[model samples]
Target: MPVLLDLRGAKSSDVAVGTSPISELQACLHSLAEPDHHLESRPWLTGIGESMSPGLGHRLTRFAPLWARRRCRLLLPLSPPLDVDMATELDRVSRLPENDFVAAAAYAVQGGSFDPRGAVTRPGEFVAACEARSFSRGELARSLIDDPGDFRRVLVRTLEDSVDAFFAKEWERIHGRLRDEVEQTRSRLRGLPLAEVLSSVSPAARPVRDGRAVRFDKLQNLTVPLGGNPVFLVPTIHGRPHLIIRGEPGFPVVLHYPVAWRGQPPSIDEVRQRLTILSDPARLSLCRHMVNEAITTSDLARRTGMTRPQVSRHLAKLRSAGLLTSERSGRYVYHRMDVHHLMGIGVELLRVIVR
Candidate 1:
């Protein structure tokens, strides 16, 4: 079941791109909040995550389910095609009606494991909300339930503190550069047809069944039909598995695409250099042997029956080609083969031809 955007009659103008301070904060919290995620968006964020006050960071982790990769659906106030008055928008969300708020809270189940206890008031409403999205639901009346007591207030307070303490200053500096990227993205789509523009949104997005629909990569692939409504492209520098597409079986979808799309064609020099490095038998043997364990220059020379100087020269060439990685142990260096890069070379070759 694909959620089609139905942008068929839409012009390029119909596509909106903008910033959401709310989303930026949310993204930051998600990206920088945990250590397990391999925070690739900002190297410095990894350090920041380590340096954050232990208690404050631990408190934020309690709400991890709400903003992690399988995040909450109740992000309208902070979601894109952003408002000019972002602060005011969040304020309005604080007043969301009781049932709607409950529904929002209910939709945030993780991996089909719906914890009804997490739903404070009207557990049945929460159960129903989960059921509506095709997640399994059941009677929650018997379970001990707690009062929600204005979820919005708690949400606003904690997020504000986290954003201020961790993200505010950094976001101010990052906001402008991302806006320029949006403009540049829009500028490139000026003369292209809507279908081409849609396909180019990301490397993973493809126009399947001609131009009638587009499919994007997800847990399961999502197909979105397009009508001339509107689609928002939210650009960011976040790594893979942060929020990407945000469509809920409806129109006016938001796609969180990367600003600097990473699947670029391999440079000619890189291709030539790596291939050249692999062409020599001694170098090839060295690469093959290093896969199982890191070998010192002297050890590699003894294994290959080559002089230490010769082995060292081959290692230097392989390192420059990114086929080898080296680590120092006092006076000697150990070389390890990057088998992963070797496997990925096929992808680079294909990209050169297709991208």
Candidate 2:
């Protein structure tokens, strides 16, 4: 379903940019499914799944006795990514006067609002001793009933190990590049209006209500419509082919989108050059014809009344600008419109110009 942003009551100051390592890690774990539904290509996760089920953590019964059941119930809900993190966002959940260490995990298990600026979270307390699938939610709640801090460490140790084993080496370069992208994303947000930012968030994000409301339809059967709460746009390098959204009646909405810098939003100078390529009528014509139809370069050349080599040159320029993405099928390569990159470039250039 779609997460509806209520732009009727929103202001320019209503939206902000935030970061969360915890959320990123959660996204990584969620992507470990065998089906690979939410990610584009996760070979590493596929390898891991071949040996173990992505749900193996929830069913850690073989390792511990009663600990198995309680931990299983609790971990599954927590496995669903949170918009906040353990370091910066944990304390806010506990509602403790000084922001205690155990608060975040407890709050998550208990379910409630998280406070950075009074950000309310959806309640995950449904498993409160409620029995389902031969498991008790109360048992899960009891797992954290005694010492939340110690329980947290136990959870972290395994999570950290699992993540480090798969992503540690890749994260150095990935994290560094994502940091740069986040910085640039913030700059662009500050430079442009909120509407423009949403327009360029992702291909799946469609603006509604005259560019005031943007419908983010990333997940199926999810419907979250906000009224007066502020929104946060948190982009990540690893979050691709998926969008994470969380909002409550009284708190801010957060949109965690993908922005992995793989030649997207090319350098400022390069983007300026790329923009000029769009001015060519021939290239624009090719783009229109290829919007929903994947055609071969030779066919595009014929349709555009250009020689095969000439069409190839135009397509190359468009691809460099990140407007077109291609895939090879045996001998012939087919190309289609990169709607996300194309719209993103629009906002990027607008930011450069308006600034």
Candidate 3:
């Protein structure tokens, strides 16, 4: 099912573009939680994991329940100010009412609606309830239900410790880039329609009902009527491979979109090298197969009717050029093309040429 945003009667003022350090911190935690999908953050996460104390690391794990499968619903910023700092946002989160915090935690566990009226008194029953929803973090959920205040403390402490560990430096490094993206997006909004602006943020967004509404192909089914509330579009560098949306009632809808690549554009030589790598007929054929699915060398050999060594040689070249990514599943290693990078080659080349 798709998540629909009814934009009926929504004005330009109803949409806003901004950046939030707290949201980026949450994204960093999520990236650390699921490093496989977030390959871009693997090196940073590895470094933090090695340098941090084990006790602090364990405390970070307490947040795993809130980040079920790398998606979080707890402690999200609700229409945060454009210049909101991490301390201010964290303070806001720390001040949430106990019941609201518990309810948000429960929603995070199952990624669904929760009724506080149906709350269970015992920790065991709370865990059982979460388990029924396929949530495997029993102890964490139990802790949240048993003593919500202590859990809130631990959550806040873990976030604080994480900033001290690595997020502070990371945020400093990427803050300017995030702000640039927001400014550019807002500039676009000045000339483009809301639907076009939404689509530019994420390709999955589509305008519907003659631009009165927009829909996204999301994991959950939801219909949010703007009803005069604002929608915040937040861009994050660490939040790659995920587009998070929070549209709970009584709060402004927030969308955290990923911004790919950083620093500088590729040099002319690098662009030429990538173009040459893809110019080969056999490699282009291989890319056609790998673009949509990850396949093992043996599978590629069979499909292309080429020898194993030939397929390996081509795969190696693709991997070296950063056009391919591979993952090991048991005995077999599957390789897939980085479709986003591949698609951006034209823009990269144009940037270099124009420069």
Candidate 4:
């Protein structure tokens, strides 16, 4: 399936680069909820987990599914300014109508497909319909349908608590980097066609229909007509493994793309360290074995005729180099290669060498 963005009437002015703290905040929550897919942000995730109050932690866990793999669209600002801050965005969310909030939450709970009218007019029938599809977040959905006001209050409070606890500092630390990405993108737009820039944004994007539209290779089939509304390109550090596209009716489409390393190429020393780590034959062999499937150290040792200690030593080197991610299951820990990081090594090395 693919998502097509029709740009027939769109011009250079219709595409803009901007940063939204609300979107970044949602991205951060998604990364925290699904940490296994974002191994690069493990340190930040661990730090936030340790620092958050127990009550906040419990609330976040309760609402994890709302922002985990599919975020509630209402959490994102409808049309954020280029210099939008957290307070302004939160204010936007705090003012959403009860019906609109319920509809958006139901859409998220139903996995991006739901009837807003049904959610608003026929709440019981809507929940029944969701249950027919094996509703996983029934309680949250019910909370939204039965008492949207309370849900909205709790949602706002939880988000505010998140910002106060850690994201305010996180935003301050990364705001400059995000602003730089936006400026660089704007500069590129001055020279390149919008289609070319769209293709360059992600490997999964391609200019289609003779550049009249951009198609993203995604899981859902959707055709979004720009209709002269501006397209906002938001770059985020914590939005990896997910290129978020929110195209609600009557609002500008938002694309939250993943950016590597604060939008800068890795340093020479960083590239050198990774290359050096992968240069060892034992470690290379271990990586090869773990490329397609995660393998336990004991299993890898048995398959390679190496002792457990030797396999562990090699795995540690790969892990330290950011080339491997591990997950513990029962008594054994499974390690897998970080293919994206591995592929970026060559890009980083080339940039360093050429620059």
Candidate 5:
């Protein structure tokens, strides 16, 4: 669902705000609000408040306007083995009051950077841009909006003309500027290993697979190269992945490319320990909701329909045993777990239970 802002008889504005990035950003966001008293009490607001970090929010805010402009369409492709019940479940969740915040945030993170109008008026130009970036512009833009085939050929041509080689060269030059800062920080700081320090300071980068090519700087890092429009490329590996800051074409900004890696598996005892607690149906259910995702205590309680005290007890135990990690997104505390590790334990425990 697109939230159209009414700008009748108004001229287009550039990315202009004089305040400090955060304050200016806050003001811009405030301008977008239409006064939702009901939103104040919803779990979604709390979720966004608690989930959004100042650092992350600032980073995202820089991209929010760009993302909002690009979110012309949102698509979910359905393949065979169609389950009507699955669709029903999705619809139910979509209508939930808590989903609004998440949806808004997801749009900012995923679709905010593209030109939604370009997908239509300049279909050929859009396709060319995507193609130059080694991606499928048609499918991607179509997935976000409505029709793909209708605008494929034209979109490709426009994108080609609009996207130029100079953009990539300019981006690489800017990246050198950012990388220099990282190097300077490295020289000034001491103690921790260089790799760890590098990962720590870079919000968009993480250590993965013992120093393989860093990921998360480019769109290609997350998706497979398919003609028309690219699709998300799910990796075989798991856990919190890393993104590399690499130079890209057509944009003079550092791009985030997400990448994955395979590492040594956890010890058998480690598996047993996590499963030992999660083996319980109630605990397992809680773990499932949290695995690979963060959720606030209140949301967890609401989702499970459990008392706060009950949820608190389970979370405490999980955190104590290192099955979960916690962070403060805003006024709320969120918990996330390693799904691969959790699942491995579950499988092992099931085998033992069956035997």
Candidate 6:
């Protein structure tokens, strides 16, 4: 009879009549299947299905989750490794004062290696590493696993910390930029009611990467498009981005950078006038509360554990003065501020106060 065999990890020709036994062949097959079995065990696959679903690049899903998959596509604008144009933009920015400061700081940490900033982040691995490193510096807890209230507090502190770190120029200019962006996000979300914000956004498109599309149906309610791409928008717990998305749960993708859609910068005088309102302690507190999204009087009372009447009075004064805006959702009203406008004012006031 002709010898027949399949080569596993180990090299083997057709087994002769007296070669390896059937048991050995069985063990080799099992060994070969082990990694695949491990891959299947990941939590992300349980929800949306597995990574081998005939789309995108091979084996990417085995590591990252569905939301992450989408985020990877979304980051095409920021992550140099994923976008060629991003790489060029980074190159041009590298010579700028902001970038030079970033390079010097990054270089100092890398044992004085004079790697070009663009080169440092050109590859996907490097870009991921940079994000990981940035998050590590802030050291936020895994919010997805934490209590919602605690998560929100942690998020807010983290944003405040990010602002402080930026003042110190910790990490680099990119880190500073990311910090500023997150702070803006927190303020933006605070000004609007969570329900209204969530309802206004709908997932318009799925990120098709490497010829594969992520499953976003589960996140239909949470999804919103900032420009053209879909983002799984989650409220900042405390004041941080806490929502997690995945094709499946455990094997999740981390989305970096949440951006707000806005027009050009507001005039300086407009900002200054707002800051004048914020100079008062009561208004400052109100401004902080309105940083991310709007809250109804009842919700604000619950959040602050204040009496509804007192909350309503405070809200009334702010609304009457145009420091905040309110909209009715059913019988209850929700409130939020103009985050970009308030922030510009707050920033300028901070500068003036410090000076």
TM per model? 0.64, 0.51, 0.72, 0.73, 0.25, 0.21
Q: Cα deviation in Å at residue 235, candidate 1?
A: 0.8
Shift in Å, residue 293, candidate 3: 24
- Among the numbered candidates, top TM-score falls to 4
Which residue runs of candidate 3 sit more than 4 Å off their true CA positions? 111-117, 120-126, 133-136, 261-355
Please tell me which model should have the higher lDDT, number 1 or number 2: 1
- Candidate 5: regions farther than 4 A off: 1-65, 69-194, 202-212, 215-246, 250-279, 282-355
The 0-to-1 C-alpha lDDT of every candidate, in the order given, reads 0.61, 0.55, 0.76, 0.79, 0.37, 0.34
| Cα lDDT over the full model 1 | 0.61
- Compose the digit string of candidate 2's lDDT tens values, residues 1-355: 5566656766667666655555565555545532234334467666755665445555322223222111112221222233343443433332333223333333333332233211122223333322232244345445554445555556656555555555456455566666666677678778876667776766556678787777764433445554456666766655554555665333456677777434443334665787798889998899998888899999998888899999999889888777888999999999999887777766555433321
The residue ranges of model 4 lying beyond 4 angstroms of the native Cα positions read: 129-136, 261-355
lDDT of 6 at 218: 36
The stretch of ten residues in a row with the least summed lDDT in candidate 6 is: 12-21
On the 0 to 100 scale, the lDDT of residue 239 in model 6 is 12
Worst 10 residues of 2 by lDDT: 68-77
lDDT of 6 by residue, 327-346 (tens): 88899788888664444454
How would you encode candidate 3's per-residue C-alpha lDDT over 1-109 as one tens digit per residue?
A: 7788887777777887888888888888776776765655678889988999998888777666576453555556754565688888888778776676676676666
- Backbone clash total for model 6 is 23
**Per model, how many backbone clashes are there?**
12, 4, 0, 0, 44, 23
lDDT of 4 by residue, 293-321 (tens): 99899889999899999998888888888
What is candidate 3's local distance difference test score?
Answer: 0.76
**What RMSD, rounded to one decimal, does every model reach?**
8.6, 11.9, 10.8, 10.7, 21.1, 25.0
Instruction: Tell me how far the alpha carbon of residue 148 in candidate 2 is from the true structure, in angstroms, after superposition.
Output: 6.4
Using lDDT as the measure, the top candidate is 4
